[model samples]
Target: MTKTLTIRRPDDWHLHLRDGDMLRAVLPHTSRDFARAIIMPNLVPPVVTGDDARAYRDRIMAALPADHDFTPLMTLYLTENTDPDDVAAAHADGLIAAVKLYPAGATTNSASGVTDFTRVAPVLERMAQIGLPLCTHGEVTDPEIDIFDREAVFIDRVLDPMRRNHPGLRVVMEHITTSNAVDYVKAHDTGLAATITTHHLVINRNHILAGGIRPHYYCLPVAKRETHRLALRAAATSGDPRFFLGTDSAPHTDANKLLPCGCAGCFTAPNTLPILAEVFEQENALDRLEGFTSLNGPAFYGLPANDATLTLVRETPEIPAQIDTPEGPVTVFDPGMPLNWTV
Candidate 1:
């Protein structure tokens, strides 16, 4: 039985709209569903300063369809040499909504990210003083840290210290994928918030390796064990205002993705909401879905819930197995078969 559903429109708190060709290719897929998104800043040069962020925002705006009401909330890319005064100036001028800290070598296109937290202390201190949120790609790039435990270690080693150093600073643990991340965010819910990805809520590391190597299912802070997946579902639909939708709908070209060392990301925007609905149904937490999707994120960011409304019906929607883009055809992440819900 398909029932019509209505909820306050949701925003994607974390998104990767890669530049140039890829930007044009995937903009519509996201804009069609989300009212606004906290755009990632990891381009080749990266949006490190206010000027760079403003210019990048303009390019994203020009790329969107004229009818699209999507607002691309910009974030400054933090580097080891980032200037303290500049971060304060940008926040004061309203040039950026948040500052993203991608530890050097953490993920895709993060080669220019900060190498040591201590080196960027001045910048971090300034952001805290002016009330800017430090959104993080929570992971350790150290060769010794087990990939699966990176997020937890990051919380213990990096985030915990930074939070202690700047007690009033707002921080968002973006695209949280593990049970440990949920526990950490909940433990610090008074001062921390996390954005849960649709893929994490529905799949585990096993799904990525199921039957055969599935490139489309791989992503950074890679999916974890079955227990983590269940915990993510519980946190996502638990009606907690600290857990919200981030999608993290990162995209990569087919050539790069199918290579020997396939790039890490999942181009799931096309099926993101559908996948979330399926997960909610499995947990029988559909009744609490709206609050997680629409209410939690805005509360975390101190923004108002979207005034518009969106509907996600439970009818089976046959999305394509792959969608052709300018870069090349990209495989979509599907959970075994056609999802029994659509948005």
Candidate 2:
């Protein structure tokens, strides 16, 4: 077996580095491995304008360790009030990489997200003209729709029609979690792609509900059945350029996560590469790991792959159960098996 592997330093196409203390605590884990990350804009008060994005980028730079070479690719949270002119200017200045679409109440800190897609049509049109991709949460917030079915339903109701209306617009169905989503991406084949999360690839609904309720294993667009997890593995490891790594490594403190109505997210940044290496190795697709982790994300976002490389040694280092931050302790995702790779 191949014991050690080296590949171009990876980029996380989707990441949530919450500002202030949480940002300081978690940024190092991502920066240590990733060269760049598409920073999520769903802050407590979302990053909605060019000014907000620039300010957030500055804060990220300041927070980054002096020795690390990492870039924060900022994004704007699309809302009914989003300004097309500002988005264009940000992209033109290379301050932002994409616009994120979160259907109102869709996920964490998404109360300010878009409710009426039609209201944002002009903004989408402007993005299409300038070639800015729309990264979407890909789930509906309808109380009636079962949580497990939201992603598949969003494809039929919201995403498909939007693509049809603006054929030139590029869309990334972020952290998709179903076979239905996989089929949609394969069928579209152009100007559209999907990001598979590291946690989703490792866990399914069973991991969340089986034996007992595991809060650390829960995440939005919550993990589906075993069959869906298999599909995600196939898409991610298949060497298909449309699918790539986006470790939606959202972090919530243990206090919040253990509450009656806990937050949804898996804090996977600390152990993402090791877990991915184990998964790809198990699937006998180690050769394609670099493409999914390093190449595909940049290809979709129109950026160059990192010139630097990361080497993963075949050694099982003990992963900490949780990481400490000023806010509180945040639990690391338990992959439920021994990981034999470490970066």
Candidate 3:
């Protein structure tokens, strides 16, 4: 029998399609490529309850193009006041796919995030019992901590203790940028896994500061050293089911990004899969792409693998060097770069 290479359609486990106009502008890109996505909850006010999350999910559906099969899996924003029983009920009801935990003052529109882990123990305990995965921002907000050290530091200081305290908990270390995160999750290896973003696999800190201050490349878990990037590439291409695709494809308006105090996130949803193929090809790991992009995520989340198929042809194509929006033109991570494959 001849071995066939079939492209399995993938779901984005982590994503940030902001509400209203921004959501409208970016939803099409992801919907066009992904069958489903676990949508982020860091909106302006944030989606904090089952009703809020469900309502927000409705809005995303309303914003989506009617003919597309893209399903937005909503998640509630975990705050210090989040009720555990309510959290469990929501997850059990299938109103939410997961619960997002953002340390207070972490990223865009996360002002209402949990200020201390202790404050949210009730909710965390409930989520653990209900089998609801806790997706994390994985950063320490303490200004004294080195920006590059935040993710690893959080794992050591916060995540480790929390995981140990609740052995039943399921954690997804979202947007992992350092080897520490990879090591920690693998060591824990029970119901814990991590997400590998398309940008971190391809770039390092130098890419952000080499030429100038590149606001477009700025993101939470800010890109790390070259060695870390290498580790990320290795981990992503290592054929590990523990690691999977989560574009974290957050889009910010040009004005918001170019400001002195710009927001943090990368808008890679439009070019996520195409770039993943190129990276895997470069690593000579094209064979493992499906597992990382499609299988691993759903399997970890206890969902069935996607039966639908997608195609990625080896072809040279051009992407805009930047995307022009009502706010302004923002640079794209893989923009205009020659790619070996596109989906």
Candidate that would win on lDDT? 2
**lDDT of all the models against the reference?**
0.86, 0.95, 0.85
lDDT value, candidate 1, whole model: 0.86
The number of the candidate with the highest TM-score is: 2
Candidate 3 lDDT, 75-177, residue by residue in tens: 9999988888778778888889899999988888889997778888888888788789999999999999999999989998989899888889899999999
Cα displacement (angstroms), candidate 3, residue 169, comes to 0.1
All candidates: TM-score? 0.96, 0.99, 0.96
Q: List the residue pairs that clash in candidate 1.
A: none
List candidate 2 segments past 4 Å from native.
none
**Candidate 3 stretches greater than 4 Å from native:** 1-5, 324-330, 335-337
**In model 3, where is the ten-residue run with the lowest total lDDT?**
1-10
lDDT of 2 by residue, 210-236 (tens): 999988888998999999999999999
Which candidate do you rate higher for lDDT, 1 or 3? 1
